[model samples]
Structure formats: C-alpha cells, structure tokens
Target chain A: MKQEIQVKCSKGNLALIRDFVNRWLDEQEVKGVLANQIVLAIDEACSNCMIHHHNCDGRSKIEVGLNYEGETIYVEIKDSGKAFPIDQYKPQAINDIIRKRNKGGMGIYLINQIMDEIEIEQQNDHFIYKFAKHLG
Target chain B: MEIKQEKQNSYISLAPIGDLDANSSLEMDECIQDWLEKGESNFHIDGQELKYISSAGIGVFISHLDEIRARGGKIIFSHLSASVFDVFKLLGLTEIVTIVKEGAEIAPHF
Candidate 1:
C-alpha cells in the first residue's frame, strides 16, 4: 500500500513531517532499527526541502509519498523548486565528511548513509528524491 | 523543543528535549541570550534526548560561539546519541565546540 502527504514549505513544519512519517511507519508496523532509520531519513529529506530548497519562503510545496511492499519501505520526496544539482551535492565518503564537520553539506550525506538506496532526478522545475530501506 | 536550564557552579546547562529544527532554533537563541545577559558564560548542552537537529540548529551554535568566547566562556556538549553525534561530526562541529563524554567531564574544566 502507499500513502501520500503534501506539506507547505514553512516554519514549524518539521513536527508535522515527523508525525506524518512516524504514523505511516507505525501503521506499516515497521520495527526496530529499520523504523528508526526510515524516520530519520524522512526527517532529513523534508528538512532539506524546507531549509535549502524553499529557503523558508513558505511558497514552495513538498510532496512525500510512502509505499510499503513486502519487506521494503519506499519514500519519495518531490519539491517544486529550482533543480538541485545532485552531482554537485554528492556526499563525500562517510569518514571524510564526518571528520570535516561540514555543516551545511551533512544533511544529504547523512540521508545517504541511513537510507538503503537513494536516487535523485530533476524534471523541469521539480527535484525528486527517492529513498528505500528494508525492514527486518 | 523544550529547554530546561540548570546552573551548576559558573556554567549554565540547557537541556533541550525534542526536535531542534528551524522553528525551535530561535527559542534556543533567546534562552542563550538570556543566560548571556545574566553573565553566565560557560554552557553545557545535554542533547541525549534531542532526537533531531538540522543546519539551522547548527547555525545557532555557530552564531553564539563568538559571544561565548568573547566572554571567556565555552559551550560543551554532553550525552549526544550516536545519530546526533553523526550530525555534529558531519558538520565538523566537534572541532568548533567541545564535546565531552558526560556532564561530569565539564565540571573539572569549568
């Protein structure tokens, strides 16, 4: 099954994002570390949209979709903003990134580390981020 | 995020439990400012219960570093969970801020 939620890019939306992801994960009965990883990944993605993409303009919108299939959870976040340079944003190796303490660039890097798989693509003016993780 | 302040010796510790994102970052700023006005220089932030934090949150710490240093005070972090520690390490905050293993480690320095 799949669920979709649309949230506006505005302040005070992080809680809403967290609640939405947690509810979906609970309903799906995702347990243990897998659940925690998915929750954190979703939070990071939504935060990136709100902070980096929209720049807190409150004008852009983020569409989050969750899909449960067998033992895997798939999440996709689409943002209606300027295209994000996926290549430029490619995260450094975990050890290198962690050692440097690069503040602004750590979000995507952490998301990549936690999620099982991450694929980013740009279509027109929209940037799409797809993440997947397997449940135990 | 909810901030509960406790003063030990010359240090003021703010324990913020919950999400430390963009919205709550301002609240922390105000709390830090209030402590600064009271001439409280040293700070220890207990982030054990803080589940989430973002760049905006990190920015808050960076903005206050100068003030704390000018006053000859330091901000130390204690009891950060593995995930939260990853965020701090990734942002290179471990270099700029002093991260101790526990609140007790700060007592000796202050």
Candidate 2:
C-alpha cells in the first residue's frame, strides 16, 4: 500500500506531518522501536525540506510519500527548491560541527544515521530524499 | 516544549520537555540567556522526558557554551531519551557536555 501528502513550508505543517506519519504507521501495523525510528527519520527529512531547503518561503511545498511492501517501509521527501548540491555535501564530524555551532547541515547527517538506507537525487528544481528500512 | 524552573541556592534547573525543534528554540534561548544575564549560570537540563531535539535547538546550546564556561558555570544534561541521546552523540556534544544518566547524579557535580 502507498500513501502521500503535501505540506506547506510553515510551522503549522509540522503537526500535519506528524499526524500523517503516525496514522500511516498505525495502519501499517508498524510498532515499537521500528515505528519510532521511521517516525523520527520521516520527521527529520520533512522538517529539513520545510525549514532549510525552502526556508518557509510559502512558494514551496514538501511532498511526502510512503510505501509498504510487506517487508519494509519506504519514504520519499520531494522538495521544489533549487537543486541541493548533494555531491559537495559532506557529513561534518559531529564534534567539529558542534564546536562551530553550525545548524543547517546536520539534517542530512541525522537522516542518514537514523534510516537504514538513504538516497538523494536532484531532478530539475526538485531535490528528492528517499529512505528505506526493513521491518523484521 | 514545556519549561519548568527549579531554583536551589544559586543554581537554576531548567527542565524542557517534548521536542525542542527550531520554532520553540528561540524562546528557550532567550530564557537561558535571561538567566545567564542574572548571574545564574549553573544549569541542569533535565531531559528525561525530552523526546527529540533538532540542530536548531542544539545551536542554542552551543551559542551559550562559551559564555557559561567563561562564567565558570556548566550546563549539564541528564536522563535523555535514547533517540535524543543519539542526536546528541551524532552532534559530538557527548564529549563537551556533562551527561548524567539520572537526576541524582547531577547533585554531586553541583
């Protein structure tokens, strides 16, 4: 089964993200630690798109899609912002980044750490972040 | 986020519960800065109930780290949820900040 949602880049939309994920997770019968992991990963990815990618411009919206294929759950977050330079992006060492007090780059790092697999691609003006994890 | 204050002697314990994301972090930063300006520096952030925190929230802590250290005060975190702890660990804050597993552990340091 698959589900999809589009959220604006406003603070109010965060609750909608949470609600959509929680409802989908419940319906999929995903529970316990696995469910929590998915929720956190999805939250981080969606929040990154809303806050960092679009900067709450109201001109952009985040599209979140979820797919369940019996064995695993897949999530994709699509943003209509300018193409993010994923090639030059490096995950900063946690200590170094913290010491410098940088806030913007940690989203991708956290998403990578939390999700089992993550893939990033830029198509035209959209940046796509796809993540998948097996539920066992 | 919910903030509750407890004062003992010269130390102030600021307990913030729930997700400390970008939107809520500004108020938190102001609250901490206000306390620092008043010369209350010894802080224990009771995070036992705090479920999640984003980089923006962590930035607020990092921004005040130097000021707190300069004043010979420290901000300690305790009882972090596993997921929150992971975020802190990923940010490499585990080494710089004093993290306690229990609220009681905070007493000995202060």
Candidate 3:
C-alpha cells in the first residue's frame, strides 16, 4: 500500500504528519513498538526539515510519501528547502550531552537510531529524505 | 492531548496522554516554567499514558534541568512507555533523568 501527505512547514503542523504516517503503519500491521519508532523518525525528519531546511518559514511545504511492500516500509520526506549535510552529520557525545543536558542536537541522532537506513538526495528543486525499516 | 497536573506529596505530578511532539512541547515547557515560578519543585511526570515524545518535547526537560537544579529541585519520570523509554535510554537520559519502574523509589533527580 502507498500513501502521501503534504503539510505546511510549521512546527504546529507536525502532528498531522505524525498521525498520517502512524495510521499508514497501523494499516500495514507493523508492530506497535516498531510503529512508534517509525513515527518518531518521521516526525524528527519533518521537524528537521521545517526547523533547519526551511528555517521555520511556515509558508514552505513538506511532502511525505509512504509505501509498504512485504516486510519493508519506506518513507520519503521531501521539501523545497536547503539540503542537509548528510555526510557531515555526527551525533554529539552522549556523556557530554547528558552532562550539559542539551536537547537541540539529539533529533538527528535519534532518527538514525530508530530508522534502519536513510538516504538523502537533492532532486530538482527539492530535498528528499528516504528512510526505510524492515519488520519481522 | 493534555498533561494532567496534580500535587503528589513533595512532587508536582504531571501525566500526559497521547503524543508529545512539537505542538505540545512548548506547552510542556510553559507548564513546568509556571510551576517553577510558583515555587513548585520536585517534578514528576507520570508517563503511563505518554505513548510518544519527540526531541521537541524532551527538549523542555533538558532546557529546564539547570534552572531546576539551581532551585534545589528534582525531576523524575514514572511508567514510561517501552518505546518512549527506549528513546530516553538510547540518549543516555536514564543516567541524567530519574526513571522509576513499578515499586521503585520515585526519588528526586538533581
């Protein structure tokens, strides 16, 4: 099955993105734990796109696509915004983060941990983030 | 979704139902800040119904840790959802944030 959704690049609108993905996952019979993880990953990706790529400019748009084939689920979050530096992405040190108690730098790290694989590519005038998960 | 509040002993207990994402993160921050300003400390978020939390929601706790510490306050979470707790565990937040399971002491995290 496949589905897609478009949302305004506003933080307040992230729930719609999350709820859409979540309903799709539920229909695919993805396990609850895994589904929750996928939901967070999708949420974080869109959030990153809105906050970083679009610079919190709510006028832009974020398009999300979801597809499930057998035991694999694929999600693509696309936006017409600045491309992210995927190669240069690095998670902050956990100890330092805990000591300093900072939260700003953990979203990408959490997304990486939750999603099995991710690929970022700029196509035409939009940046597409592809994240995949394999269900057992 | 709303976060229910109560006064439990020395802790200001909060219970959130449904997901805690971007839209509600600010509300969480503001709620805690309001309590802090009102001389309420020993924060305890009852996570039984808290199914999900993104960075935006967790950021509120992290941002206020310093201020709460300075006030000799503590923040603790109880009965976190397995997936939600996994995120916290993955981030090593269990070390910094007090998370109590059933029958565990709901102690202060300072």
Candidate 4:
C-alpha cells in the first residue's frame, strides 16, 4: 500500500505530518516499537527538510510518501528547497555534539540509525530523500 | 505541548504532554533555558505523559547535558513509557544519561 501527504514547510505542520504517518501506519497494522521508530525517522526527515533546508518557509511545500511492500517499508520526502544531501552526510560524533551543545546534528544521526536504506534523488527542480526499512 | 513543572527538592521536574516534535521542542528548550538562566540546573523529566518524541526532543536534552553537568547538576528521566524509553535506548542515550528505572525513586539518583 502507498500513501502520501503534502504540507507547507512550516514547523507548525510537523505535528500534522506525524499524525498522518502514525495513523497510516496503524491502518497497515504497524504498531508498537516498530511503528514508533518509523514515525520518528519520518519526523526527523521532514523536519530536516523544512527547518534546515527550507528555513521553515511557509511558502515552501514538502511531500512525504509511505509505502509498504512485502516485508519492507519505504518512506520518502520531496521538496524544492535546498538539497541537504542527507545520504552523503556524515553525522557528527555524539560526544562532539554534546561538547558543542548543538541541537542540529542528532536528528540526522537518528534518521541514519533508524532507516535501513537511504538515497538522495536530485531532479531538475526538486529533491527527494528516500528511506527504506525491512520489517524483518 | 504543555509542560507541567513542579519543584521537587533541589531538582525541578518537567512533564511534557503529547508529542514532542521539532516545533514543540523549541518550547521545551526555552523552558530549560529559563531555568538555567535562573541558576537552576538539576532537572527530573517525568516521561509518563510524553506520548511521542522525535530527535528534536532528544536534542533538547543533549544540548543541555554539558552545561548542566558543568554546573554540578544532573538531568534525569523517570516514568518513561516503554516506547519512549526505546527512543533513548535507540540513540544510546541510555548509556550517556541517567534514567531512573520504573519503581525507583528520584531521590537516590539525585
């Protein structure tokens, strides 16, 4: 099954996005820790796209897609904002982040840890961040 | 998200209701900052009411860990639902931070 949601790149819309993901996952019978992890990963990805790349510009928009096929779950976020190259991003060491008292890098780290596969697809006018996780 | 604050001896306990995502985390960050500015560092976060958490919420805690420790204070969490606790475990925060297991009192850790 496949589902998608599009929202303005405003931070205020994050909760709505999360609710949509959670409810959709529920409809797919993905619950408990697994569902929570997927939700967290999606939240991190969308927030990074909106806040870091688009500067939470209410004028910008982002699309999130969730698909379940066989035993794998695939999620994607598409936007026309700056491409963060999350697939190429090397998350900073946790110790370094704590030492610097930074709040930014951990989200990417969590996204990497949670998602099984991550790819960046940059098109002529937009960018797509694709992530996959195996149910096994 | 509404964060319920209560003073518990030398530490202040904060319980955030509902999901703690990117936007709402800013409010939590500010709450901690306000207490820090007022010379309060020790914090006990009650997670019973926290239904969901994203990395942004986790970041709020990590961002303040150093400063709080430097001030000779500690930030501890207790009463986390299983799923909420799993997020901390997933990030390996369970090793970096002190969390009072269920059925344990904050006094011992504090």
> Each prediction's TM-score against the native?
0.75, 0.85, 0.89, 0.96
Residues B1-110, model 4: lDDT tens digits: 99999987789999999988898999999999999998998999999999998888988999999999999999999998878898888878898999898888886677
Q: What TM-score results for chain B in every one of the models?
A: 0.92, 0.93, 0.91, 0.96
Docking band of candidate 2: acceptable
Instruction: Evaluate model 3: give its lDDT.
Output: 0.82
Over the stretch B40-81, how does candidate 3's per-residue lDDT look in tens digits?
Answer: 877998898987898888887887887777778888888888
Cα miss at A60, model 2 (Å)?
3.0
Off by over 4 Å in 1: A31-34, A90-103, B33-40, B48-51, B62-73, B79-106
lDDT string for model 2 (B4-108, tens) is: 889877578888877787667887898898998888879888886776677767777777776777779888888887767777786667888888876365767
Worst 10 residues of 1 chain A by lDDT: A94-103
Q: Write one digit per residue (lDDT tens) for candidate 4, span A1-136.
A: 8999999999989888989999999998999998988888888888888887788899889999999998899998898945787777787877888999988787777788889999988899998999999996
> Residue A84 CA error for candidate 4 (Å)?
1.2
What does each candidate score in C-alpha RMSD? 4.2, 2.6, 2.4, 1.2
* Per-residue C-alpha lDDT of model 3 across residues A30-136, encoded as one tens digit per residue: 75777888888888888888888777787889999999877888988888856786535798776565458665788888888877778988878878888888885
Question: Chain A in model 4: its TM-score?
Answer: 0.94
C-alpha-based local distance difference test score of model 1: 0.75
Q: Compose the digit string of candidate 1's lDDT tens values, residues B1-110.
A: 78989999879888888878767888888888888898888998888788777655665666677667777988888888776676677555676677888546677766
Report the number of clashing residue pairs per model: 3, 0, 0, 0
Worst 10 residues of 4 chain B by lDDT: B101-110
Q: Order the candidates by TM-score, highest first — what do you get?
A: 4, 3, 2, 1
Best by DockQ: 4
Better structure of 2 and 3 per TM-score: 3
